[model samples]
Target: MKSKIALLLFFALTAFTLLQNRKITGVVTDEYQKPLAGVMVSVPNTMISTTTDSLGRYTIQVPAYALKLTFVLPHLTTQQIDIGKSNTINVTLKTGRINLTEALADHQTVHRKVSGSYVKMESAPQTFMAPMQRYQPGETENYNPINENGFQVASQMPVTTFSVDVDRAAYSNTRRFLNNGQMPPVDAVRIEEMINYFDYDYAGPSGEHPIAVSTEMTDSPWNPGLKLLHIGLQAKTVPTKNLPASNLVFLIDVSGSMSDQNKLPLLKQAFKLLVDQLRPQDKISIVVYAGAAGEILKPTSGSEKMTIKEALDGLEAGGSTAGGAGIELAYKLAKDNFIKNGNNRVILATDGDFNVGISSEGALQRLIEEKRKEGIFLSIMGFGMGNYKDSHIETLADKGNGNYAYIDNIQEARKEFVQEFGGTLFTIAKDVKIQIEFNPRHVQAYRLIGYENRALKNEEFHDDKKDAGEMGSGHTVTALYEIVPTGAKSPYLSKNDALKYQKTDASDIGKTDEMLTLKIRYKKPDEDQSVLFDMPVKNISRPMAACSENLRFASAVAEFGLLLRGSEFKGKASYRDVIARAKTAFGKDEEGYRSEFVQLVKTAETLDNRKETAQKD
Candidate 1:
């Protein structure tokens, strides 16, 4: 009887064990019905876990005692569900706030290609372009070739649609000296005009779309008291649940210039942190450029994390820079293991020192431009101090259709890799361009702050072939424009006798409501053509006192840009104004970026006062 009891007990135990190992399977999606890949599905309170595949399908064995399961992705709000006896649980995740209509409303239209006529004009031969050379608004210029009656008269003025406000802070901060006057010491502080140009944080999708914006018109510097439209764009973060596998190639610059503590050494540590987060399917390749370019390690699976870590550790600073060779080798490796339809990228980490090979800016640019055609994306991580080439790095990133970032420390690496994984790794959209047309009636002359080099010819705004900047996930760019009304007593230039015949009468310009139009153009990551977005600016002015935290913060950033550039339009803008604006705009301060800007302002004040004193002496 005892033996019989033992056999029954054994059977019951075996059946329970089988029940505990039962499998659960389901597909994860977003509200849009798009599959969410790379989402983590795991039992609560245990190391047991599984990740979803590209199709958002997941399968995991659930132990009988497991009462709950959780789905998690970096930067996403985590979700948990109770697991009673269900064999499958389908999950859907909400994306971060990004309202497309709202964001595009305040910017200019972005189109795939400029109108054919505009292209023909831009590409016209030098002989036929004499009249188009210097823009004279509404002038009837005569063509050299005589018609049956006489010289052909044609209106020759560049068609411009948008205007931007210069940053007051940046304009005031610059040190200007009269010609042949005693110049102050050059303040070679490291400043990224572009990166410092805007304020963007990772916010979830707020409305139905991926971008949002609010625009207003304010006083212009050129025209006294005249108001101009100040438009702002707020892009929403895309929800990334299960992203595809990433094949990353790390091209390291170990040149002599990178021997600084903040250069080569910091690079290794930063990359190591990135490696710790890699999954088994992800692959990494290490390429070093010193005396010559060579691959330190072939593409290895992320499962071999230790191997990558060891290779990174073995890297040492020595020899001259062969940036050209390094890039070629890295691109070759990327092409060899091209992961079709996956994230294939070459991340170049350097101090911008390329002295020995492919050092010329033009040569390097050409190489990067050519390689981009192969479907391999590039990303540049700038490091180190003294002799840093911000321009070089910027050009490379721009032409390669990639993003550029400066790494001041390891914490920044986390922000780039772990915190902003989606923005940094995934390309949801590309080639974003903003163009705004100012109504002649609403305001007077305007100037765009910073992007002096990025300014497109009036017609280039619609040309799709012309490359524009790429916005990473959750990245926000802000532009401010000050406008003067027709009757406002601002410092605007009136058409003199030379321009009198070409100029339109002040009465011909439109009113404030019709003063400006915003246009935006962008393409999906895999698309070649861009979509157009347009919005009219006509809202009544809000009390400057009631602007949202985002608006105020953006204003402060604009001011900083003006101060740096030493713009002539810094009238009535004091250091006090910038600081006060920043203080009021400091909301939530999640990353303390605003607070840091405040400190930067203090430093800027000191610099400005010193320069003033030198001028007096």
Candidate 2:
């Protein structure tokens, strides 16, 4: 009787202890009622911490002594609540920004001022969210909240951010060639400009608000010499609550040319990783083409991971590429399983070798053009190395009203899929174009670096029907301008007194607000008509030595791109300068991107020096 009583007492104590340690479960969100994924929820004084999942839901066990729990996200105001008998706690994180003006004013003693041949200036009151806020591992924040009707509603405005750098020297060289009535060097082509020419990121109305642009400017080279201007813009992302079910068709190429380890195999791994993020409501279909096209699997829910894995594993490289047929069948399947108001997309993975039917470029272009009208979006993922058809893939993407990405490895795949889920998958705005008019008084000669193919005739700026690129959610696009001061003597343009169109005595022309005007055109996600926005340029000239941080970083990136392309305009640029400029502009070292850039410069230097030595030999 004594032993039984002791066992019963032990059981009672255990049950009480278990009850005391019970977990709290709830969802975390932002002010917009969107799920806030990857938010860290933890007991403030303890080592216990858990992150919210894709649904922004988290379950964390806490000790009885724990008084409260805190939820935190980088660049967001942290939230904390007292722990109670209730087993659930929902949290909402408020977005925060870092103001450059505040930092500068708070630490005026640390700021160094210097003057050189050209004046330099720091960034103005710049406001930006931390990189972690933009891209955090495992972060999944909903863009919209579910409505009372049980259907997900869309936000009114969709926004995105984009950043790219163009080599100034290369741009100038291309312009010089154009002025001299000659074809520019093939390497002078700016891919970023081409990519940005069309908006690929913007998705339409979630029914919340119109998109707004917050722009910041900084000096270039991040050094005393202001050689560039860094421009950054942020747009609010479109919100999607309980988004309609999606039907995705993966059109893969298992051709002989794609037998490289980084080709077919890499494609498989990338797709597998994406599959992990798929929701139960999402359906995936796999189609493979070599000598001919064939459906490997019908549409299946994401829950059937094993079945999808099996299909991907069985794929083998054998015959010639039949890209046309493959695309046709994939579109057919997508049309059959069309989800009303949901994302219907065909993701084509290939090395872009189309050797079989409809191999003619025009024919392939027409095929995609016709299908684009059906509301199914296309995205081209290029893989492999040698003989990769960048041109062909680029054309197909352009015609199909889609985007193209070059996946070098698994990391890039993650950057595209996991890190930028919204931008990669959803379209908020389309046919976005930018046109800048420069005043002859403020700038003698200005060159737009990069974006050779994206350049439109001045009249095309107002043409709404003309197709442009789409901007995705949370993506940033940046452009730079290098202007020669009005009084500056032209280095390449010679004095031609005999020219009939020559005009003299125009030296009094000065800078004016009309010196430059920036015009942007974009269409709402579901609408065909476009809206225009314009900003006039002002005579805000600072010494080149006092360029802002944004300017410095952008200049460095552009210089690096020029060096990589080996353009003739890379006159005085050195890799060392690029590294120095980037390091200077790297304020917080948040994601180590600046550091990585320095390393890439070292690599470029080694490669360039080797080439120089080989040429001498």
lDDT (10s digit) by residue, model 1, range 1-617? 99999999999998887566668999977655766555667665544566665467888877777788777643234567888788989987653322222322322221112221111233211111000011122432111121111110111221243312111111111111110021211222111232343454434447544555567654332234544345565555655546667789999998776765456756776787678778777889999998898888999998898899999878767678899989989999988998877778899998676778777889888788777766678888877544665556766877877776766544455556666666676665566777766554444455544455455676777777777766555656566555444444544344433245664555654434555667877776667788777777773566556656665666666655455545455555667778988898877665444665665566567667877998999
Instruction: Give the least accurate 10-residue stretch of model 2, judged by summed lDDT.
Output: 149-158
Backbone collisions counted per model: 70, 58
RMSD of each: 19.6, 17.7
- Candidate 2 residue-wise lDDT, 116-148, digit = tens: 111112431211111111122243211111111
Indicate which candidate wins on TM-score: 1
Alpha carbon lDDT of each predicted model: 0.60, 0.59
Residue 54 error, candidate 1, Å: 28
Give TM per candidate.
0.66, 0.64
The per-residue C-alpha lDDT of model 1 at residue 541 equals: 61
